[model samples]
Target: MSRIFKVAVIGGGIGRAHIAEGYSARPDLFEVVVLCDIDPVRLGNVGKQFGIARQVASFDEVLAMPDIDIIDICTPPSLHLEQCLAALAAGKHVVCEKPLVGSLAEVDRLIAAAHGAKGRLMPIFQYRFGNGLQKARHIIQQGLAGKPYLATIETAWNRDAAYYSVPWRGRFATELGGALLGHAIHAHDLLSYLMGPVASVFARTATLVNPIEVEDTATASLEMANGALASLSVTLGSARELSRLRLCFEHVTFQSALEPYAPANDPWHIIPNSKAAATAIDAALADWRFVPSRFAGLFAAMHTALVDGSELPVTLQDARNSLELVTALYHSAEQRLPVDLPLRPDHPAYGSWLPEPFRG
Candidate 1:
């Protein structure tokens, strides 16, 4: 097994967070070989701070480097598809941040690139590594949840005008969508991960609290393939930022923390509703093993999948499922009707959703 793989990071802000995690959690596994950003100041600052000798002004430079193994994309959502396609075409694996692209068609193109290049592509849904979320996933897969009945996902984060003042923060073209796309994506991914793929969505959105061109608040009702009903609320005008998920089943109940960004690491309360469920859960936990909270756990898993020929936790199909939900949610909001799952290619809102005129 290789001791360290060369990594190049594009973009500075959130890319720095991923770099910090990579350096802190498993320094022996990854090396920060290159840093790329359009802003030379930010690029030089990060390269010097991390002692990474190679500082490039554009992603193309990083892609040209023969030694680079992975490209960690930290740019805005709008840039993901192009960067990912370039990296994969250059024979480097990709680790792009969530909300991969503004449209499902772009996602399909990236997926095709990965297929042709035979390079790995991982969408950063880092919240999956949290201990709490892992625990809930275990219970559900173990049948302790006994066919989920209902679930609720709530993401209320306060992002005032000052928050959107950042140059690329609040525009339809750059930020992609709005509260649902930017803020609540993680929570929504969590919901889809726990429950199954959604079959339909009915949604309404508003730009009430923020001065951005996008919606700051959205409410959506979901119907899952397994006959489970779910509700989702995403907002950026709350008093504080928090996220929580509640799942009710025939035999047990699972509840996760409301922490922003790290909800997966918190403790989850699993209450068995009956003696049979209690015994089943207890037996499962007796054989359970604990995995440490490493930010590069996803990378590690992907590495293992690459070397050992195992299944990747987040696959292209998984990304498609997440993107499908994003597309469906936006379509529902635009048409003001329940948009069904597996949207066709000709759907008017297939690639984007424009906000309606505010009646208020």
Candidate 2:
């Protein structure tokens, strides 16, 4: 029998969801042993709500628990790197929420730390785990989608002053970034996941909504490594919220559901260019097996990878690639020039992507 991992979730806000997916959703694979948060009230509330008997106010307590095999980080962006480093050093496997680190340099540092640590780190990109997106990935990997041509991706959602009322929501120091980094990152990640690496990016940004310090709207054009062209647009000012993706390949065109949050879940339209092509797509999808969607699916895959010693469903390099695009988009928009791929340590935005005033 495989060993069941014991988990300690930190930060009670988003951590509540992690408890639901990691512990409640897969009891056989994971045991929710502890909960940690800075706020006693919120922590107690979440612990009682989830029936988690053990609760602690300090992350140090979480790290010191010998029974806790995994440290699930659902904290603010500012605390992620520190918590991840400490958890890994304590010989605990880690699962962290998105916008992994604030900058490319921090990501590099975490990658190096992960290599030397006894434990492994898995960054969450739950959108990639959805059934519909998985089917799309299978079709493309099986060579049924043919050569990619173009992709149009949009992450449009409304966020007014009330949404940013949370102290960290709009600040670069805490939230890390505005719409491009925080809001649309998952959509951009899905784009790269489907089409592969981006070769270059040219973008423009605006602070048209909610008088925030960071941009609330942005647009960018991308050239994929495979020679495919793509465009990305993001806004927190839209009247109607939607996350959409349209991919046009040589053999078929794939359109995702208009789900604002769970766009990759299901009910996608996979249209072929011809009747023969349609047959091929149908054959490819016939072999598709359903996986649980969102956080549950991510945790399930992680459980398999940890127990079976298989490759992670999402990798550190995948996180790096996503951050590379984020860096490029910021560099492009700030410089008013197209930025190229593989941003290195020498890049101006390597240490931090935020502009001068926002860097503090």
Per-residue C-alpha lDDT of model 2 across residues 1-360, encoded as one tens digit per residue: 657899998888878887776568888888888989889999889999988889899899888889888999999988889999999999999999888998999999999999999888999888887788888888899898889999999999999888889898888889888899888999999998899999999999999988888899999999999999999999998899999999999998999988988889888888889999889888887767897788899888998898887988888888889888988999899999999988879989999898878775
Best by TM-score: 2
Evaluate all candidate structures by whole-model CA lDDT and list the values in order.
0.81, 0.89
Candidate 1: residue 187 Cα off by (Å): 0.8
TM-score of each: 0.94, 0.97
Model 1's lDDT to the true fold? 0.81
Model 1 lDDT per residue over 215-236, tens place: 8899999999899999999888
C-alpha RMSD of each candidate structure in angstroms: 2.7, 1.2
Cα deviation of 12 in candidate 2 (Å)?
1.5
Q: Cα miss at 30, model 2 (Å)?
A: 1.2
